[model samples]
Target chain A: MKVALDAMGGDHAPAVNIGGAKEALELYPSIEKIFLVGDEDAIRAECQKQGLSTTSPRIAIVHAPEVIGMAEPGAKTVRRKKQSSINVAMDLVKAGEADAFVSAGNTGAAVASATIKLRLIEGVDRAGIASGLPNEHGICHLLDAGANPEAKPEHLLVYAIMGSAFARHVLGVKHPKVGLMSNGEEDEKGTTFTKETFALLKGFADSGKAPFDFVGNVEGHDLFETQLDVVLCDGFTGNVVLKSCEATAKAMFKWLKKELTANAVRMIGAKIAKGAFVAVKERASAESYGGSPLLGVNGVVIIAHGGSTAVAVRNAIRVGMETVQHRVNPHIEATLQDVKR
Target chain B: MKVALDAMGGDHAPAVNIGGAKEALELYPSIEKIFLVGDEDAIRAECQKQGLSTTSPRIAIVHAPEVIGMAEPGAKTVRRKKQSSINVAMDLVKAGEADAFVSAGNTGAAVASATIKLRLIEGVDRAGIASGLPNEHGICHLLDAGANPEAKPEHLLVYAIMGSAFARHVLGVKHPKVGLMSNGEEDEKGTTFTKETFALLKGFADSGKAPFDFVGNVEGHDLFETQLDVVLCDGFTGNVVLKSCEATAKAMFKWLKKELTANAVRMIGAKIAKGAFVAVKERASAESYGGSPLLGVNGVVIIAHGGSTAVAVRNAIRVGMETVQHRVNPHIEATLQDVKR
Candidate 1:
């Protein structure tokens, strides 16, 4: 598979992206090619800085003049900066030169660029960003992570369908259980949007239009548990929960380190507890799931965080490859069609 | 201060409530009196079962005929069951016989009963439930935690003022920084409600109506950081984030235990890491916050979790006493008046 990587899109930029591309080429072997999209000279210099040469048969560069900052406005920046790294990388996916595109850049820009460049699948109103979080039972997929801040009930219904499709294809869940994120588990305990969405989901479940199990309402507390496979919500709530969890985990680790190093006895204890600490660290790391996938778009678009490291970038590339192999877009479109009919 | 304890409200009922009351009376020598509100026979029997005796100086029992189940509907149930433990406890607060009332009962019923029984402070449109979460920088308060699920922008502004007052008087943060929670940090990123709210908050800051620093917007990642002292949101989102954090912490601890007990080496390591583990456990535990206070009401009303223990109940009583001492209601009324004028 050929992947287009946004070489200048992340905090680590060309260095991490180039290093990850080199590693992907070395490990996958079957990954025939990678189009490193960024400014020519900068990309070349960073490749050398990382002790990597970009002259390999499997790797090449497609020079793009502009780079989108992580803080740039999504629609305005994406529309005006046509030759940006994200835009060019997505263009490669649209033109079928790359099976998937990966970027560790601004999530809003990535979503907007992908949707405008590659177009949405038929019957899909809006594209969503779906991220997988490690839960106590297993992994839970949270849909519409930040793509559409204010979504209608119809939009959420689409998220449920698309999320279910992604879970089945990527995680190998036979029949994903979908749940609506609400303040309370009862049907009457949510906002107007939630109430309307609940009724639509119930209709879908009763009619058996979708393949997944539509579990009623799941509260915020249910997110950490694998009570349902795909948890659906509007982007606003989903993004808040995602970022808060990340922040909390980071804060917990920082506090743990401080407490463990406070006294002589505890420092000695920390040495013996190293293995358990590693387990906890691994469980909290965001890179475990690589990047979130932009669902409902006509092609695969994977968005890693701007602060992604080499390992995260490499994981993102693998995710991109897997998404293409699993044919997630087609599956999503088919499910949407079934729901519509 | 005298506290009215609802002995019939929680899942554990008289056992936990009575035990908590006993602990409270024992722990806080400053507390002058306690009124155990529930069935007189059950309260007396449980006190005897624990081999604990409460003299007239420290404890008394108020007979109530009904108990609100955790699953009961809010408005109807609270009205019909006037003799319920929650109602009777509130009566104590209303009659000035007790400084405050504590209940490990249904949250909705408590909020409803409190709002109707202890009318809103003058010029305050709505009441909110504010819960404090421990953070590395300090404690962060999230208001409208689940009180008014369908809150308007004006209601959110009220929450901000009430939350700011709580942080100032109870949490002791001077000139607290208040933020409106939204999907993005940008002023224009949220829905109509958030956008209008952002403008209003900015106006308040410009006009010096609100004393706290009106930080423009905060994302979920700021929840644990010192970026904002208090976060303001409509009840729906606030409730979702609150529950999500709680559930995520619980799941993490559960995973940590299972992982630590997997092998003998790790088990021994865990034994040595007990101090560090306890620190992390205590930091994540919600009991430290005691319970959520229904702010904006004329009198002190605390809604403890239906699963609260003795430590939680005692801490809740302390919270009530502190609120009364701080004169939160009077301060709020004066602040609202100042804003209006």
Candidate 2:
């Protein structure tokens, strides 16, 4: 299996990407190759500096002339910068040269490039970004994290199906339970779009066309309960929820550390509770779940965090590889067909 | 000050409400009046069982003939059940018999009753539910928490103004900074509503009519940071973010406790780290911030948690009193007029 890595992406740049590529190659021996898509000279230099054996036959480089800044418009940048790292990596997946593509670049650029280059499945109208959130029970999937900000009821229905497919195939969940994220848990609690989407899901469930259980509306508080396998919402609400959770967790950990270091007694207490502290930190870490996957697209596309480190990038690559191995795209297409029929 | 308490509200029902009212009277000696609104017999029995004193000259009763179920339709229930506890309490505020009203009842019913009885302030199209999110860096006010599910850009602007006013007056922040919550921090990252709202806020900032500082768009991740005093968004996005944050904090605290009690060694460590644990718990506790206020209404209306205890109810009453004392409504009206002018 081959994976295309956008070495020019993320805050850590070529160094983190190179380190992650080395780690991925070591962990998965069956992974025959990695096509490092970026400025060839810069990536190679970073890899050499990291004291990695990049001279191996399995390692290769694909030069890209341009880079898309995080602030650039997604549609315009993807079209104008055709030779950008994201675009080039996506091309590798489209041409079947690489099984999957991983990027820690601007999310908008990565999403737009993937959708435009690899194309969407026949029945999929819009692609969604799915992120795994760690909850008390386990991990739950939130779809359309920030892809389409203004989604119609039909778009939400598609997200539900695609999210369910991803959960079942990649996350190893059987008979995944799907839910629409709304203001309240009741049937009549959401906006026009959510209400319409709920009706559509109900119809699909009654017709026995939906692949998983339609568990009705799930509120924000339900995200951490793991009551549903997949939580579906329009990009706007999903993004806000996703970002707020991330911010709150970071703030909580920061506050804990500050309070622990405030006095001598608390400092000693922090030392005594180091084990529990580590447990909490590990559970809240975003790197534990790797990167978000852009579902509904024809090929695998993983969008890692912009601030991703070596470990996060490696995890993202592994995620992309697993997605290909599990054939999530084809499964989503089949599910969409079922929902339509 | 006189407060109307809904005796038959919340999951705990008459017991919690009755006990809470007694505790409030005891805690706040200056609270001269209390009207227990519910079935006269049930409230009197509960008060007697708790061995509390409600025979003071300030104490009174307002019997509500019926109760609105939590699952009832907002508009229909509010209109039909005019004698419900929620309606009766709101009526006290409307009739100027009480300084403010407190309820741990159904949120929809509380909102509807408050809106119908108190009426919206002139120039304000709708009322918003505003909650104070307790983060590591103090508290940030989030508006339209679940009031209006489908909001226009103009509605968001109004929410921003109301949230700013509440934060400044009640939370004691001078020139509260307001932020428009969006998928990305970039100025152009939101949907049409977000983009237009951003432009409107910028225009306000440029024109010097806006009293608060418009801090530009804030991503969900910034909620914990004191980047802004008030965070503004439509009801749908705001509600999702609010619920998700609450759930995440609860789950994190629960997980920490469970991890600490796993074994004897950890248990001993927990004992040693009691101070640190308390610090963490206190920092994440939601009850510390009191209840969420419904803004833009003619009168002060606070929606306490449905599971509120005596302490929560008392704190909510204090919030209502503070809003009244600070003249938040008039301040908002004046500021809004300045913006229009």
Candidate 3:
């Protein structure tokens, strides 16, 4: 597979992205080439500093001088900066020069660039970000995690289809259990929008044509407690819920650490239990999953966290390759074609 | 202070309710009377079984013949079951016989009964539940925690005033710092509803007449990271964030325990560090705060968790007494009256 990565994306920029590209080249034999899209001078300097070969046949630098700021307005910045690395990288995917596009840059800009450049797949109303959350059973993907904020019930219906496809094909869930995010588990417990979405999903589930089992409604706690594969909600709610969970976990660990070091006895105990803490942290960290895929786009697009480390960037590239190898987009298209609606 | 307890409201029912009432009477010398609103026979039986004096004149059993099921529809059930314990307890407050009403029962039913019976306070359009979260600086109250789901921008403005009054008077903040919960901390990072609410709040803050310092937009992480006193949002978002945090905390502790007990060395360390865990758990426990106050109502209404233990019930009663003693409602009224808009 060929990939075009935004070399100047994320907080650490060229160094981490270059390091990730080198690691991906070493680990994955399937990668035929990687096009580093960014300022040529900076990419070369970072590549040299990292001890990576600048003349490697598998690596190529596509000079894109402009760089989008992390906090810049999404679509506007993408439109204004025609030579920006994110847009240039997306263009390569549109031209089929690369199999997938990866970025740890401005999330909004990455999303906008992908949608504008690649367009939407047939029968898809909007693209969504399928963010991964670690649950008891495994990983549960929450769709529309700040991609489509103002969505209709029909949009959510489309998200369920896309999310289910992503879970089954890329995430490898045999029969993905999809749920509508609501305030309560009861069928009647939701806002007007969720209620309407619930009706559509329930109807589709009753038709016996759905690829996944429809779990009527799920609460916020169900994200961790239930064995759900995919949970669907509008971007506004999904984003807030995802961030809240992250913050809570961070605060819990911080508090635990402070208390554990309060006395010598507890400190010694903490030393012995250090491995346990490290194990749990690695399991819970976003770096494990690497990136959230921007689903429903015509091409593969993976958006990594802006503060990604070199290891996280490597994993993100792996996720991008997996999406391509698994042919997740094709599965979504085929599944949508079977729907009567 | 006289308090009305919904003895038949919670999952534990009359048992925990009675046990809590006895404890509250012993703990607080200021409590003049406790009216246990439930079936007269059931309350008397539980009180007697718990070795409590029934004829001491301090504890009264009010006969509430009907009971509302936990899963019953909220407003409809409140209207249908006129003699339900929740309604009876709310009626006691509406009639000026009780200074506060406390329920560890169906949150929806309690909110409905309180809103219908006590009505909204002056200049308030809707009632909000100010749910507390233990943060780095102390506690940050999230407003509209499931009360006003479909809130307008003006309603959120009112929530800001009420939440500020709650934080300053009831939560003991000398000067409360309030924030609008959004997906990002930027000036333009929320849904249209939140953006409009931001404009209104900004206007109030700029006028130099607002009691609290409006801190613009804050993300979900700010709930734990920042020294915020109150964070305002619609009930739907607030409820989801709160439940997600609760679930995350539970999952973290469960995973920590499993990992810590995996080996002899770690198990020994876990035993030595058990005290630190207990201290942090207590610091983060909902039972410590006891209950969430349904603000913007005419009377003090505290809603405890449905599965509250006896200790939680006792704490709920204590919160009720504090809300009354602090004159929270009157302070809210006085603050709202000063606003020109």
Evaluated with lDDT, which candidate comes out highest? 3
Candidate 1 lDDT tens digits, B1-341: 88998888778888988888888888888788899999999999999997668566778889998988887777678999999988998999999999888988888888888988988998878889887788666878887788887788888787888888888988788888888888878777887888998988888789877868888888766878665668888888888888888777776677778877888877776777679879887887777767778998999898787778777887888888888889888888888988888
The runs of at least 3 residues in candidate 2 whose Cα sits more than 4 Å from the true structure, single-residue gaps closed, are none
Model 3: DockQ score: 0.78
**Tens-place lDDT digits, model 2, residues A182-209:** 8888898888888999999899889887
Q: Report the Cα interface RMSD of each model, rounded to 1 decimal.
A: 1.6, 1.5, 1.0
TM-score of each: 0.97, 0.96, 0.97
**Interface RMSD for candidate number 3?**
1.0
lDDT of each: 0.84, 0.83, 0.90
TM-score of chain A of 3: 0.97
| Model 1 ranges off by over 4 Å | none
Give me candidate 2's TM-score against the actual structure: 0.96
For each of the candidates, the C-alpha root-mean-square deviation to the true structure, in angstroms, is 1.7, 1.8, 1.6
Model 3 regions more than 4 Å off: none
Candidate 3's residue-wise lDDT over B35-69, tens digit each? Answer: 99999999999999999899988998899999998
